[model samples]
Target: MKPPIAPYAFIAPALLLLLAFGVLPVVVALLVSVTDLDLAGLADWANVGFVGLENYRELLADHGFWQALANTGIYAVFGVPAVVVASLAVALLLNRSENRFFRALRAFYFVPAVTAIVAVSLVWGYLYNTRFGLLNHLLSLVGLPPAQWLGDSVLVKFSVALVAVWRGTGLNIIIFLAALKGIPREYLEAAALDGASELRKITSIVLPLLRFAILFVTVTTVIAWLQLFDEPYVLTKGGPLGRSTSISLFLYQEGFAAGRFGYAGAGTLVLFLVIAGATLVQMRARRFDADH
Candidate 1:
């Protein structure tokens, strides 16, 4: 009796929390996705009605949905690679030096990751301002035109991606550094004995060992960028004709601003599906890469 009761007592709190928070919300959202839960519904629960997949069908026909999806894809395609490369490079550079200054730099780089998103977004917004911004000021010093980093269609996504990359690189750097530390010194020594150059040793030894870290970072980055909201929301409100509007922002506006809760729920479900599918593909690709 003590053994059985003790096991249940120990796991009961965790199970309760998981059911109350995780399982409950997912079930509620799934139900909401199939119904017409709107501002009216919020005011009076009786106002809600089952709409089935109407919201999803509406999403299929919505031009804004496709546009947001395309924008997110573009961001992930470019930003993920940039982040992976930058993180790996920085980790490699830092791995060579265990000095106190370099240790401090690691902490400094990771500061953005732990910082509040809204605070970071506000700072980046000021930096991206059209006039009297630090970025424009630097451009002036170089005799370059003061480009609208967040206002222009072509630059808005890139600017948002830059902020995300800045925030994310630190995390990936830590991950890559750990991966780097695990590499056997004998591998490097053997490569050196075989007359391998620095680049060759990295390509042949370091990268192969870091593949798991790379895959993990890339997958996580893709998922995060797909649901991007805060940076663009604070900076431009998905503005300049919605060029910076991501799926997350679209869903946010649909639910909160437009009171289209059902529509937003459908969008949320779609985004989840997309993330799930992408993760599966990435896992498969990584396994294939490892095999060969």
Candidate 2:
């Protein structure tokens, strides 16, 4: 009895912290979403009135809300695959050589993973400048016309996606590098002895073994892209006709910037549901694959 009680006591502090930080905030947000909380409400508690799903309904009808949701989907759909593929490619390239230079190169490649988004945005902001940017200057050197990287509607979407891919792939690349290293030499040697080509071995053996890492990168990249706030906020400010406005940015604009706290909470809940649904679907798919 003493032993069991002591084990529970040891974990109680962690449980209390979780309740205070995680559970409490979410519960409070849920309550706020159903009420007409705003700047006025912040001034006077009596000003806050229960609206009960009215905010949610308003969000469903708002065109800006829908467009932001769609824009977020564009990032998740486009950026996640690009990040996964590029990370895997770079990981595979660097995996071939275990030399000191390549090891240093791998370390360099991971710089963007830990770098602050604010810093990346500042650097890329200059890189995407219309007339004087390095990227456009190089394009002009090749006789191609310089294009607006962040101002044009269509290009801005892909520009931000490219920035996301650039900044987001470093961590996944390391994950894939580790995954590739973990593959047994015996399997590749066995394939070589059987006269299997490099491509065949990769397609048949390497990829199958790296499935978990691929799924992990895919799921997490998608989730991160869905929450794309910092990049667009810093670079485009979700501008050029608001073509690049993301759900998270939209929430920020509504809640903190606009002082529509209830409206913001509703949008927050919507994004939360989207993320939760994606996670559940991925879990189900993974379980199904495992079962099969």
Number of the top-ranking candidate, with lDDT as the measure: 2
TM for every model, in the order presented, reads 0.91, 0.92
Task: For candidate 2, give the lDDT.
Answer: 0.91
Per-residue lDDT tens digits of candidate 1, residues 1-292? Answer: 4456878889999999999996787677788999999998999998789999999999999999998888889888888889889999999998988999999998988898899998998788788887988999999999999999987898988998899889889998999999999999999999999999999999989988888888888998888888888777887788788888988998999999999999999998898889989999999998898788
Where does candidate 1 clash, by residue pair?
none
Off by over 4 Å in 1: 1-23
Clashing pairs in 2: none
CA lDDT of each candidate? 0.89, 0.91
Q: Model 2, 1-292: lDDT tens per residue?
A: 3456878889999999999996787778888999999999999999899999999999999999998999999888888888989999999899989999999989999999899988998889889999899999999999999999999998999999888899888999899999999999999999999999989998999999999999898888878888899888989989888899999999999999999999998888888889989988998999899999
In candidate 2, stretches whose alpha carbon ends up further than 4 angstroms from where it belongs are: 1-22
Clashes of 1: 0
